[model samples]
Target chain A: MNAISSFTASLPGACAQGLIWGIMALGVFLTFRVLNTSDLTVDGSIATGGAACIMLIRSGVPAWTAALAAACCGMLAGLVTGLLHTRCRIPAILSGILTQLALYSVNLRIMGSKANQPVSVDKYSLMLSQRYVRAAGLSNPIPLLVMIISALIGLAYYFFGTEIGCAVRATGNNRVMARAQGIDTDRATILGLIVANGLVAFSGALLSQYQGFADVNMGRGAIVIGLAAVIIGEVVFGKLLALNFALRMSSVVFGAIVYYIVLQLVLALGLNTNDLKLISAVIVAAFLTLPNMKGGDRDA
Target chain B: MLEMIDVCKTFNPGTVNEKVALDRLSLRLEEGDFVTVIGGNGAGKSTCLNAVAGSFAVDSGKILLGGVDITHMPAHVRAKYLGRVFQDPMMGTAPDMWIEENLALAARRGKKRGLKWSISERERAEYRELLAPLGLGLENRLQTKVGLLSGGQRQALTLVMATLKKPQLLLLDEHTAALDPKTAAVVLELSDRVVQEHSLTTMMVTHNMRDALAHGNRLIMMDEGRVKLDVRGEEKKKLTVRDLLEVFEI
Candidate 1:
């Protein structure tokens, strides 16, 4: 009875976290699956988002406005990485790494060199918070998070159907073909990076608000978690759902939800919280390798 | 419609692998000219085509297209006036996209891409009519991914895409070399029909000596980055395989 109640009590919190992290996972899906680039900038940019949002809110800015600023901060980080890759001729992975390394200091500066900053819910009207996870009233965080995720998905689905969006997809699908068609692949790449990092930062901003504080190390191993969500969503829901872009994206969110609920269960079962990163790494590696180990290596 | 003057290209300068790919080469094409290019390996045949297509900056030269000096234009920007089909079937189309989506992409080549929906009802109807002549049944498979298409089918689709926008110049870099003999013949035929119907200025590179002679009004043989033989009109009509072999032996 005790174990069951504890699990039930923790389920809502885990769901909230999953939904929030699902936004970051959507960003990962954009760069990883859509743009076909393994961007590592999210790790540092998420922290930048958190730092920017909390700092802005602490300075008396509105929460929503602060979230937008955080997303812009993330977009700038992606732009730096994009320019480094395109204009400076650096490889994609290395450019992301360099930008992530540089963002460490930038995030620190944003937080006034402090390792952490707290946004008091009593003093500020945050959009979503842990306090509202089980609240009986309209302040429940799940509905709002779901609404936000749906809105983002709708926007993405619409955008990707547009001319510029098709060009971006073509750029990722085949650079040579894109160039042949007069699509500026460099511009497409930069735009994809900007949009991806913007989502990641936006998630970070929401996460900081949810947790009531932003820590410098909060975004550590974030890419792994995001990937785990993506892979988990794809592997689990892919067979059950119709193969549409929007459904695939929504699966990524569900993947995050499932991931957190499982994490909560593991912790309840006596797994050390500190070893969660190792477990995440192992999970991602296994999931990443499973498809390749099967029959995907054979070419037609 | 196309001119290459004093074009020069050297690969890996200052290295042991340094090779002069194009050495002060020059060529001129009249409007509506369809020229077939032939060469042995290392003859800079593809390099010459790539230079005109702006794949890379020429070491030194001027390339004029339809009275526009495009010597320094970036490859994508230059694509506004040019259509290109590569030897590799995979190089010409986005594999993950649908057939109609790929056509839609090519339809907007060199044109501004905005927030408008990529494919419309009118464009879909146009694509169906355009693809109906190809006889590949692609009109009904508009939503089919290009990756699922055969190499020959892909090349045919690429041909349609290249000419969809009526480019100022069309470049075929051994476009049919990778296809089977039958498929190559069909693509080559389609190439001729499209080029003639559109009155397009075209440059086709071929490894098959007979194909070089068989198609196009003018034929040029490239050797050591220079034009060893250029024949057209009566001189080109009377030429045979023996004469091309003699030139190759030299």
Candidate 2:
């Protein structure tokens, strides 16, 4: 009974973490599913966002402005990966790895060589934080995070419906067709990576603010987490969300919430917190294989 | 409307797999010309169309469309003046997109894409009207995904899309070679109708001899990366499969 109560008590915090990571997962969906490319740059850019946002806040910038700056910084990281893949002809996965390695140094420099930096919830105003997760009224973090995610989804839906957005979709679906129709596919790819990484960085900024600190290693294994949310959402809510683009985006976040809730449940069951990454990897691998295993009757 | 002067393209130069795909190939087409290309395997028939479409950089030579030099232009850049239908129907349209969305992409060819909605209300109506004539019942299924359509339907849709913007030149690279006999004939008939309706300067590559003779206002045979025979107008109409076979044997 005591364990059940404690698990219930921690549920709100887990929910908050899931919502933040849900935004990150949406970014992953854009690259992995929409653009048909697996970009590993998010692992590093996520930390970059947190670092940039926290540092800017420390220098007295407003929270929203700091978050935007962090997103732009993330976009720059994506641009590097895009150029390396499209212009230099480096393979997509390798290009992302190269940028991710370089960003490790860049992130450390952003934090002035510090391994971690903390922002006290008491010292300054924050958009959302753990302290507010359980608080009453407007101070509760759930409403704010929900609103942010909704707004982001709306923006993404609108952008992708536009002429340029269709072109990008075509580029992903059929590169030869896109070129035949006169779309500058290289530009479209760069734009997609930029948008995807920008969203990832924005999520990181919010994550740092929520957790009350920015750590150099905060973004480690972020891609895996984001992918987990995406695949989970698809496996669980895919039928319900497959009708429209907006629903699909919402399902990704829905997947994240489910993931965190389950994580909280397992942790409450006495699983060591340090083994969380291993658990996550196993879960993702299992889910990813489900589709292939079920449809193995036909050979390609 | 199109000219290729001293065009040369070599694959894997100086390597064990080296092959000359286009060797000093030259051809010219008047505006509104509908030319059919026939050749044996590796005769550079498809390579000629690919070169004219700017698929890759030619080793040396000039390609001009409507008297404007396009030799150095990239494929996508040069697409502003060309419409293409590939052998694989899947290569010419995005399968995941809606039929109307695929048409919208083609409609914006040679134009800058911006923040406007991909398919406007007006454009949707226009697409419906354009698709009505294909007799494939596709006009009613504007919201359907292109991937769900059969190979023949996709090719028909692609033919409509290629002429949607009235391209300066239309290149069909064995556009019907992959289909069954009935579907191939349907697509070919549609192709001829579209070319005539728009008077599009067209180049169609085919391995089937009768199709090469039956369609197009002109016919040309290629051998070993060079033009072996060029016949047009009255001469093309009178030539038979036996004559082409004789030339092939020689």
Candidate 3:
């Protein structure tokens, strides 16, 4: 197969990963974009989800169910940040850091005496009963993409349309307006964190299942990756927060696809593995400055 | 039907920046009473509305709506009885959602929200009916994102959304103060139509002395956190912008 066809064939995988990581993008989106609060909780919540899913899946729960439970675990992790921020009057960013630090140990305990689990090597053997893979045919990426994308779009569209969604959006855009409209800003912040982290952990659950294990180190650079995808998504649409639901979701999904394609290109070109971090950093810097890269003057 | 008894508020309490926003500030509103308030910066106009809406717990006060003591209720709990439009158009609704979605959220005020579908055909029809009243051609734009609307359109929509649930009190905190003169006039007309149609008790704060006298049934002027002028009935109808300025010596 030519490089082009090969590249086209792998596009769906990247979209699916983008779609999954969009959950992380969403958590990042809420704290950063929507609530206008800087929350670093996602760095730890991603690992929390992976650890919970790995531990649960090891004890004989279905992978799908394990993923859902992991999402809940991630939500509780966010709840900690919310409580700290609201009850203690701490700044939102600092509260996030406190929770992120505490969850480091909490996540360690969820992994069953291990710091992390590797799924590519550890999960292939135990993913599902033999009958399931045979039934699913293990040959098509379309089904997985179909399921994940549907969940992301449908749930996202619905959640942001509700009364609570309005409250959350209002809180982020202007706390004073929310208060005038009778919305409890504290409650809105807490709700945003719960939903954001829940989606992040959902991505983690899928990440472990698809790649075949969870690792403690997996979440170390997650905030940067998630922010990159979100920023890339925003760049595609010009980062207008008030864009309609479709554009809002597209920012994150498109971002993830572009991020993956870049990595795939690097892998295909035989780039040194040790240079991955440097490559990621450069790409992030470039994307960060992409709007500025346009010939338009910054002041203009 | 709203009452504030000796409402008192202090900001940055117990610190060097301690400032009294409201001090022994008492106010009352009978059913369908519309009052306009004007004050200089830091004159406590916004703080009064905040205290009544439960945005902050007043240090010492009792707030009652239709004779129910709601002084201690959280903001959301009191929201059912209060409809509000803010100075900024973007402050009122979720801009990312569709116009109808914003309307749906407002239309169901005081009801429990569930995981069920939010915008059904019936809900859309209801939203269309609500938008039809505005006559800004917004009923046709239910699918549009509210963020794409003009400032006047947003404030008009906000007025419609505020009254959709028929709250006991409608509060406008310089809602049109942020708009241009022409757009502000359109929004003010919409506000007048909706408030009169619902017979809603209302309080509006505006810097423009003319707007303070034009639409509402009564008018109030605040100076240094106190009511400097209050007029209603024939006295209010006979008053002009000059009368208001002379009364407050502005």
Q: Using lDDT as the measure, which candidate wins?
A: 1
Candidate 1 CAPRI category: high
Compute fnat per model: 0.90, 0.90, 0.31
Docking class of 2: high
- Score candidate 2 by TM-score against the native: 0.98
Candidate 2 deviant stretches above 4 angstroms = none
How do the candidates rank by lDDT, highest first? 1, 2, 3
Rate residue A15 of model 2 by lDDT.
90
Candidate 1: segments with Cα more than 4 A from true spot: A1-4, A298-300
CA-based DockQ, model 3: 0.30
Clashes of each: 0, 0, 6
lDDT of 3 at A96: 84
For candidate 1, lDDT tens digit of each residue in B90-196? 99999999999999999999999999999999999999999999999999999999999999999999999999999999999999999999999999999999999
As a whole number from 0 to 100, the lDDT of residue A176 in candidate 2 is 93
Candidate 3, residues B33-116: lDDT per residue as tens digits?
999998778888989887877878999978999999999998877888889998889888777657886777676566765556
Worst ten in a row by lDDT for model 2 chain A: A236-245
In candidate 3, which residue ranges exceed 4 Å CA deviation?
Answer: A1-38, A118-125, A128-146, A158-185, A209-212, A234-251, A267-271, A292-300, B14-17, B240-243
Give the 10-residue window scoring lowest on summed lDDT in candidate 3 chain A: A126-135
